[model samples]
Target: MAAFFKAVNAKIRSNPALSYLCSTHFWGPASNFGIPIAAVMDAQKSPELISGQMTFALTIYSATFMRYALAVTPKNYLLFLCHFINEGSQLTQGYRYLQWHHWGGREKAGVHGAVEEAKEKAAAVGDKIKEVASK
Candidate 1:
């Protein structure tokens, strides 16, 4: 078993795409065990806790893809970028979700407020674009 994994690790390290797929090992545990557990323990009274449901869903997503992605052959390296982007976006969204839902530090409030304002402005810009497109 150790030999098998050793060979597998070598293969993974040799290919950029496989190296990216292997990163799911870190993300899987963060999504599954870290965020939801921390939220329950530390943010129990806070209304802005990261959704445990979403965290668990992403955990399952990462776990499922990690198995499938690692089996990808070198011939299909071109398609691997699509898979990497998909997983990268999932993890990025998870990070943003945690920041938006869980962070409440006093020092970061100014930056957080700016972010909220930016979101509102972006929505208005989107509405304007839609209105122009309709006309």
Candidate 2:
């Protein structure tokens, strides 16, 4: 099991997008699982507090996921689609928490905003490449 995970980690590390995706896939669910358990065990701790922390964590995960999604190519469309659906769900949930509950801080806005920025930059670069190729 250890060797299997080690090999997977090495493969993921070879690509920046894969590294981010794998890290989130591994740690996001792990932390999410523990957050509820910890909250339940600690009566004195507020559930809202736990939820707020989770939203913040999810925001980071969503941003990293966005970067990974943007880096994926058509050759990996199926794999990208699978991760997109999974990560997009998390992104939506995190955004809802911020919009409705206002539990998370402005950091969510900044990180979430990066997704749009990355998209714009990628489009511009693609356009430039096309223009150069045409010339």
Candidate 3:
């Protein structure tokens, strides 16, 4: 098995393109790219389906891995690029989550909307008290 790998390695190293294709540097990032691709595809779906906690977690995960990719020996730019794209997608997902759950998106009044509604009622009551006092 060792001899087989040794022969294959030797043959691969002779061609720059094949050498790159065989290296961990190439394949590691290549595999990691699927994550960002999936996130991007998922973004097209409704924000109602997005979990705020999961989106926040993935955003942080991508940020941490992006730094790790750059800090590692040989500086895996492909991996960095993968995580960078993932980070963007995750951030966008986070925004969507906030919009849906807090900012009253999709015609559904959410937390922010509820708070605003409560504040308006309170102000109206306060105005009535001042009007009665003035009279």
Per-model TM values vs. the true structure: 0.32, 0.28, 0.72
* Whole-model lDDT per candidate: 0.57, 0.56, 0.89
Sort order, TM-score high to low: 3, 1, 2
Which residue window of length 10 is worst by lDDT in model 3? 104-113
Over 29-129, each residue of candidate 1 has an lDDT whose tens digit, in order, gives: 44444433444354334334456566557556655555565665533332333344445545555564666656544235565678788999999999999
Tens digits of per-residue lDDT for model 2, 50-96: 35466567546645654665575523333344444445555555455
Which candidate leads in lDDT?
3
Candidate 3 residue-wise lDDT, 17-109, digit = tens:
898888899998898888899999999998889988888888899999899988989798888999999999999989988888677785564
Task: Estimate the lDDT of model 3.
Answer: 0.89
N/CA/C clash count, model 3: 0
Ranking according to lDDT, highest score first: 3, 1, 2
Off by over 4 Å in 1: 1-52, 72-75, 105-135
lDDT of 2: 0.56
Give one clash count per candidate, in the order shown: 0, 0, 0
